[model samples]
Target: MEKCRFHEVKVSAPSKVILFGEHAVVYGMTAVAASLDLRTRMRIKPHKSRILVNFPDVGLKESWSPEQLKTLFQHKPNTEILDVNYVYLDLIHNFLKTESSDLRMASVICFLYLYSLIMDEVGIVPMEILVESEIPLGAGLGSSAALSVCLSAGLIGVLHQVQGYEKSIFEYTSSSIQKEVCGFAFLSEKILHGTPSGIDNSISTYGGMCRFEKGNLEPVRLERNLRILLINTNTFRNTKDLVERVGEKRVKYPDIVKPILESIHAISEQFLTSIQEYNQDLNEKKFYKILEDLMDTNQSLLTGLGVSHPTLDDVCRTLKKLGIVGKLTGAGGGGFALAVLPPSISGKTVLVAKDLLETKGYTCYQADIGVNGYVIEVVK
Candidate 1:
């Protein structure tokens, strides 16, 4: 492998949905999560001697000579990512006359960090980086993880090409590719969620159903693909804040909160068994019932923890009234809720459900879960 100007590379990572377990996952509870079709897409191209980053999703557009990014890199090399995530998110975070966007900063940090880390081995020409995402900004749908994964995949993909890393070896074992991407995404997750649980990065990088428990992750094989109606409460919530709040509560009310946390873990455990049953037997009715019951339980536990919002409640109630099971999917102060569609559901039924939910001033996306994860393509 040798350094050479590669024409272009495109990479994308899917947003993730938590099928079961949320705040509880932090406390050794197993959580089930899947990747969504919605994704953050990034494209990179060689430029002469500077870097250009465009994020239309957040109204951020900036170009800097390599020296500028290098200066920022040296400004505080050991400054923790949490510091960058919390306050200074971009090279321009303190620059005069620049608008503030934390997402913009985080994305910029990942780009610079990964570029610098890999570019040490081989110098890269200035590059054009364009980032756009279909995933909502603050919705707990793994937006930050996805962004980080995309950048990681993009940089690594380009790195491999520039180094002329053997494609034949990477060709036979793509998991190796995902493993590298996941590692970088996890580091990026630290910038986004502070002490991230690692599930979001894993799910987004692998792009499928995973049972993540107590720091160990294993894949779950489902016989049939699942469709979920992702409804945004149009609510904004921060994962770090919600996670910290739950931690505070646990310490404050150990007896009460501990049991509840265990109960939530039980729900995930039960759901895992039910999924095995469904996959083993292809019993849609049985699995749907289990999912409905488990989601209801999960939602109640989350509400008990004080994370549920009025909008989240309304969404859940609406779905329950229609005999559709639903629950809050993420940090849940208010962000997104999900209704897993039964395998027998018809297109008309789904459309009606989406319309009814949309009429309530909510945004709805119909996406299949457990899809493929991060991907890279070179434009020859």
Candidate 2:
């Protein structure tokens, strides 16, 4: 492979939201998710022979030498394809030791892990990788997934330029590159969420609406556009804690919680049906009506699982007063709640809702459903 002539590569990935089926999605239920307007962007440029990373959100700046990083991986098989496994992670754990417990430091570890693995095939060249995020961290908005996707996509993008990727008769198209990026992001997520459902990374890498069922993803179409109001509670909530609490409830009250979970599953099905109806040019009002009722039921089920917090309830109540259909998305202890607007919702109504929620001590913003997934661009 020839060396790259380009000096820099920049790539951006959109944040994602779970429209329906968050906790339920993890439990073999169907879930609907969409790409958010917010994005996390990554810019990479060649430097010396060391890896340098910049994460401004948390005041993190670090650099690592190629020799220092390679010891973390047995770098097995010495194949053309890059491979990452437990040996590398164990080595990384020992390398970071105390710092791995910190989220910021852990992310840096993940970045280097992915960086070294991908760059191995193309040969490592020193470079500066900078990240900037518009998505709020720890809000169940797929921030980590976006970052991972961007890194994988950015590095692979640079590889394309270095090896003269498009000159061959057969080469990867944009879609194939997206899947490859998502694959690496999935591996990286295992380090972030332990056992992730893959929905987050898939949506983050692809940037569109998806119906995830039993660990599989299929693209779903939206008939008419739906505008949503994403209100961040600004309240810190641990997704691991929330997911554990729900599991405990299921264990203690199997008879009681079983039906509720089933109901939640049913609601997801209903949500899918509504989308199909809307796509078929059916009644828009009727479709949103189904959504409103399902939101009420789904939120109630989440509350039963002990994932609901005061702030989440406050979000629901505020939206309820405005007659807007809202529910907590993702893990939902006290992170973010979504208010789905009606098909005929007026700008005045949206503004009023935002104003009311903001006045009530929440961060309110607007996003749309059914949007483009991910794209790569050259930085000139």
Q: Which window of 10 residues has the lowest lDDT sum in candidate 1?
A: 79-88
lDDT of 1 by residue, 1-380 (tens): 23557658887889989888788888777888888999899998988777888988888777888666666555433423322343334543554233444545667766666666555566545788999999987667888999988888888777777777777222533767777778878877886666877888898888879998889889998767888999998877877788898899999999999998899889988988888888787578878888888898889999999999999999988877777888998789888899999878788877777788889999999888999888778888
Estimate the TM-score of every prediction. Answer: 0.86, 0.89
Q: Which stretches of candidate 1 lie over 4 Å from their true place?
A: 1-3, 67-103, 168-173, 238-257
Assess each prediction's global lDDT (C-alpha) against the native.
0.79, 0.78
Local accuracy of candidate 2 as per-residue lDDT tens digits, 1-380: 43634558777888888887767766788888888878888888887677789999889888888677666645533424444466666677777664445787867877767866766666666788898998898788899988888888887877777777773112344566666788888878887777888888888877768888898899887655667899998888888787787788888998987777788888888888878878887787887788899999899888887788899898898888778878898888788999888858888878888898888889987877666666667666
- Backbone Cα, N, C clashes tallied per candidate: 4, 4
CA lDDT of 113 in candidate 1?
62
Clashes (candidate 2): 4
> Judged by lDDT, which candidate is best?
1
Segments of candidate 2 deviating more than 4 angstroms = 1-4, 48-50, 65-84, 93-98, 167-175
RMSD of each: 3.8, 3.0
| TM-score, prediction 2 | 0.89
Cα error, residue 206 of model 2, in Å, equals 1.5
User: What C-alpha lDDT, on a 0 to 100 scale, does residue 187 get in candidate 2?
Assistant: 78
